[model samples]
Target: MSAFFPALTAGADPGRTAVRCGADTLTYEGLARAAGALADRIAGAERVAVWATSGAHTVVAVVAALLAGVPAVPLNPRTGERELAHVLGDSTPSAVLAGPADALPAGLDGVPRIDVDLAPAGAGPVRTVPDAVRTGPGPVLLPAEPDDPEVPALVVYTSGTTGPPKGVVLSRRAVAASLDALAGAWSWTADDVLVHALPLFHVHGLVLGVLGPLRRGGELRHLGAFSVEGVTRELGAGGGTMLFGVPTMYHRLADALAGDPALAGALAGARLLVSGSAALPVHDHERITAATGRTVVERYGMTETLMNTSVLPDSGPRPGTVGVPLAGVGLRLVDDDGSVLGAYDGETVGEVQVRGPNLFSGYLGRPEATAAAFDGDWFRTGDMAVRDPDGAVRLVGRRATDLIKSGGYKIGAGEIENALLDHPGVREAAVTGEPDPDLGERIVAWVVPVDPGSPPTDAELAAHVAESLAPHKRPRVVRHLDALPRNDMGKILKKALPGAG
Candidate 1:
């Protein structure tokens, strides 16, 4: 595939603003020139590490790396010395770019450093008009072969929600395809302005938040971090027509918007409101729609596959289901015997697998794990899903978190959890199988109460569950907590729960 950035830059209006951060705005022409200059400076480097905070400098660094035919590994600006050391050791980048000279990681004695702030514009009569780098006679078009669709382009490390994080390798074609599908699916236009508040390192922000809009020549407003006050201010600033966020972000925004009616007017200008990276609770979805007069389009995706499925237009947003597969993507429900389960029958529940151009090449540098995840190029998603009669995919739960074997009888924890969540008093619930000598394992339920002071007693909850579920499927033990443990994305950390290990 061709370099997407160059193509986008070639087509964009050079005088139009590309990125806006706080009071800073970089025009497309200026951005391309800066990226080209920086690319020329780092032409010889194989790999480069970018450690600057989110802003114009960081964007330039990323574009420069791509232009120079080198892969850039973006580290969280707040990354500590120990974490930086680990990343440096793992990636062995030829150079590091930081905001300040002192921000550089320690112990890299011999590696050459180019202060991004001080990089000079290329010498020669400056071209007045914007031109495609590929078409121009310059060092910017380095000698690089056509990108193999399978070669790793971006190495994004997992968030370690379950265990030790691994770097996921996504190919150029995968990233390009994901961008194309997202633009086409969302109906993105050059007139669209995206209010981006998430960090850039993760897939949600990198591919969807940043590259997706850039590829379509849409403007991006980058916020340093997520905050209700900051988001409200940016939304009110005008020109923000689209919003993307996680569940936690939506909850915070909903609370903020509820207290202030004026905030609703600011958000009313947006055309699309999206929630992903974690499950968007049904209650939260209802609250957001009621407050903003916009439906939160919740989709399911992971780092391995940038995006596999999404809720489409002309469809009523299902509260629990994540809609059907995206265009160019194929979804399958497979049993242990490798039989493809048909979606026509609503009762079928099996492992969700995806085969498509959007799927990643593999996990970086981990052949064994990568090999195990694929069955003839189809990725085993490890998620247990049941498709309804309307073809909407409702996630039952993770296979690792669902099956609870007790006395040789395997029980699905999702069934029990769903039953518990059905209770009006139950706010959030998680079910895990704790070891028991008598039954081999017993079902344990951890619940967050709707009202903290008036949480239902264990006996009451147990009896309530008994009415709807089988005797064996009811929770043997119920533990009330203030809240269920969730990660940065608002996904409940099942592995962290008691007896989950």
Candidate 2:
């Protein structure tokens, strides 16, 4: 098989910027030299760990691991101690690659640290690997021998909702296939300079944000932190062509666009604006489109399966729908009784099961979980969705929490949440199902109001929801909060909400 990054060795424009974070920049030549040297040091390792900070060092370390043909485990930098300990114990990486300045947590005390060096070729001295951990041959600026496509590339851990986080082993082919499919979907090209401030540990930020640009031979400008001002500066100055963001980021931009013409102009100038990690609220999407005339393209995927479906750039914006399946991916909707649904009437809800080259190998060391995740060849996604006649996938909610079986109706929490968001008094909303004596499950709305002192009452909110949607879909109970709990990627943590019990 050919190399994952053909530009690194194919004598592309060496002077072009490959990756950058603030003042730190790495040209293709510099990246090849630095990552190549680091790859040589970790060549023989069974698995390596990357302290995935939102910086250039983390990118270099992961690229080095891939070049060395070693599977890399990306650990979130801000992970709590107990969870971090669990991940460290579960993955059992031989060495943890980190920036010299990063203060690693005590959970990783026993693991040997490999300091990633990003200094220019002649810029003073650089950090070297400890003699005890350096078992590979001398440094060489070349790809490792035997470019096997089946070799594991990354071991990304999933969020442990039910239990401890399981390691998802993504192979080299999966990563390449995902990026290539997304490229086709988005009309991505080397001329497109992608900009985002997504967290590096997750697939959205690391694999798609970082690796996608590399695979396309394009530039990546990562904001160390996300801010509307920073985003405006990058795109406004004509440096960035593509923008990748989650809903929260777009929500903030939508809120700010009214007063910031520069921000609006910058967004309007971008070739593509993509949103993932979570669904962008229709209110925010509409506000953004109204302000900048750019509809944010939303794509759907999970940790186990990479890029599965994306709204094609030419298809126009169809709010609330994640577009058709990508190339080489086989997707189907299965009913509760485990029978396949053939009709695409856009009303029937079913679990999404996908089989494709984009899927991960399995959960690392957990055959039971790996086995349970799949039914025959298709991987059961646990996500519930409906398909339009044109084959667009509209996710209603997750089967575990988002799907509310109440009064003999299968309602997706997302639509309820979207309806609640449309109300001017509501700022943030999360819909969930609570057990009820009368109804099988009661739809509960947890909301952060625009004005806490004069928040909307339960009756008013319920009436509002009933006005927009069906009467049965209205929230039976409404809980007001100052704010909603969210993960690093800006996804609302429904289980963490107060009164979740």
Candidate 3:
């Protein structure tokens, strides 16, 4: 509805802190000047690539791109050379933007590089910023209000867990729609200080974590790197009111809270704590809530969809469910046969389909894939979920990966994983299905036990699952592992697990 972000800075207090990353701080006035100066030089480029590292530079690059009305392509700093090359070839930006020479990651040999130095204003160590960047006039800034909301804002590449990563084209309208809806849904305001130590490459971290605070005229405190000490110190200082993190981050916090009463007391003072990227285990949720007197809310969305559903900020904590659809978002569960689901029974699992202004335009240069992604107007999310009577949605698992048909019964591996996590002896758990002669796909549990010397046996684990859930949902076999492989955002790479046969 309003200009994405740049306009918010115009009439606001100049001294208000807009961002804080590590030791760096950028006031709203400073951010506007930095982004405006950089945007001037690159205004003509249709697209630009940002070395999306977690810090001031990534924030500046993305904001400059938005101010210039050019699409910004965020490249994962940990992206492999092959994946990096594919994104470069597909998006074909005029230049790759990085913070400084040393801050840039490897793998950009052909593209022209542009550096923007965001050293705090009135600094002694400010020679790194080129003369052009310091004095050059910026291109025409985005209108006070959006002249064209449909204009492309970002070209975010997917994780490519299955195939080559595709560029997800997000429009200005979609980005604005999502952030505005979230601000309303969460009751976010300029007075709120958002804190997180998440990576800045994906939607969870960059779009919402970085851009969200900017649009809402709030202060963002980025940890640069996450640590229990950093979280406790920041929250204890009374600087942070809200937190955004993945399940793994919350898991670490939960463990820390168990040991530190001060940390629990600090967290108890925060207004809201939200978790995403993956389902937070019900056990961890209980542990944190018991200690902090606060439950972390979980939200659901994908790269193709900016933000869809979230646990209502006002509602009581419903661990394991991702809550209801956001304003203007349409959500429905569809059967395998494409039939609409009946009333909310809380047990019937079906695929999630959504449609709204928050949906991405399409995958860059992939018409067939884009066409296949949507069922008519609704985007086929491929994620499975069950809705409760009050419209809250509980994520089951991915259809291609996490759904296991065992002995004619459809099973969600997530439920089994939670059941396994509940075992006192189990510290970490992941559930998948392997081929079996008797059952269609036998349930296999991968666990990192609390006491490695005396871990839970397959029979013991199976009995534990059976006692909590149905007898048929027990893990048929158990595999021991030191740790489960996870991506930067804390999602388990189920495909990496062995014994697929």
Candidate 4:
């Protein structure tokens, strides 16, 4: 196939708007020219580091790097100087791009820096001709011989909550396949204008939100930063047809619309609204639907595999489940002994293993780490899950985040939370294992009460738990919360919980 992006832009009007940043809009043609110029500027660099906030500049810079056959490492703009210095030391990028020169990290003193200017909104005539640097090119060719599908296309670092972030190498074929799979799975078409607000450095934003639309010749309206008011305004402008947001974003939108019916009417034009990156609580889901009259389709994915499963059309999206594997993806659950668990029995819960085109090739520069993540061709997703009779996959929880060994007993916190959610007064619950001096670890329950006035006491919750759970499974400590600390995707930050080790 011809280079994927050029094919999408071919025959299309170059002046058609490709990105909208605040008051500025960059047409497809303008974006291409800027990308080409940026590519030429970094032509001599083997790899380039870009520290940018969400916007057109970051997107174009990334695309330009890919076009120029250089590996682009996009770091969070909020990354601190020490961390940036470490990345600079590791990658030794030939150049760096950021919004402010003074904000640049200490180690990038010799690296060339480029500042991007946001295009003015409807301020000037459309330029038909490509810029000099872009037009001067005879034939743009991929610099690296990426014939080996396993070679790294982009190196994305993890968020590093557990430890220092390590570079994950996503291959060209892998990234392309992910885009294709997502497009096919969602039935995305050129007519679709995706309203994207997620940060570009994240996989969900880069592959699914940006590349997926571009690969399908779809339009993208990028919001610089996610804000309830900004999104409401964008929706009212009549361009966005679909939206993908994290659970926290959904909750915020719901809260905004709940107080204003006009805001809800503005969002009514969207065909679908999706939630991912974390489990979307049932309350939030119901609230969003009540506010916007749109069902928030929740999907499950990770950094290693962009998207493995989803709640799709025709399949009923059960309240607590993440639906089924996406099209062209295969999933198998394996026990601790490596026995492949079949989908026939609904009750079988095991470690989720995935084999799909969307899976990342390997972790960059870490062969042992990459090898440990896979079992032959199937990637060993550390998540624990179960497939029900309806073929829906219910995420039990992450293996690393789930099982707790305490007092000579293995406990599954998800099972406890599931039990607690069934209680009348419990709106939301999260169970975590806390380190104990004598018992090795102890189960702690953090609950959001439906009625704050009559919240369930520790003894009351213990009695309820005792009725349903085994002796060891019952939580010894119970904490009540108005809301749990959650990320943008609404995934609870268990590690950040009070009294958590």
For each candidate, give its TM-score against the true structure: 0.85, 0.95, 0.94, 0.85
**Which candidate, 2 or 3, has the higher lDDT?**
2
Any idea what lDDT model 4 has? 0.72
Between prediction 1 and prediction 3, the one with superior lDDT is: 3
Q: Please write out the lDDT profile of model 1 over residues 1-501, one tens digit for every residue.
A: 125564324444667777887656777666666666666666666677776466667777776666566677777766655666656676778887654444555555445566674234443322323232343343332223235655556667676545556667677788888778877777877788888777777778777887777767778888877877666676777668888898778877776777887678667767788888866767667777788777877777888888888777447656667888888988888976999988655556788999899887776567888999998889998888878887888776787877677776656666677678778788788888888999998889999988989988888888877887667777888888887887655678887775467
Name the weakest run of 10 consecutive residues (lDDT summed) in model 4. 119-128
Model 3 TM-score is: 0.94
Error of 3 at 409 (Å): 1.4
Give the C-alpha miss distance for residue 155 in model 2, angstroms. 0.2
Score candidate 1 by lDDT: 0.72
Q: By lDDT, is 2 or 4 better?
A: 2
For TM-score, candidate 1 versus 2, the one ahead is 2
Q: What's the distance in Å from true for residue 367, model 1? A: 2.4
> Where is model 3 more than 4 Å wrong at Cα?
6-8, 103-106, 119-146
lDDT of 2 by residue, 1-501 (tens): 117877676457877899998878998777876787778778889999999999999999998898788899999988999999998899899999999999998889999999998852333222322231333334334554345788999999999988899999999999999999999888899999999999999999999999999989999999999999989988989479999999999999999999999999999999999999888899998999999998989999999999899999888877898999999999999999999998898888899999999999999999999999999999999999999999999998999989999999998998899999999999999999999988999999999999999999999999999999889999999988889999999988999998684
C-alpha positional error of residue 9 in candidate 4 after TM-score superposition, expressed in Å: 3.6
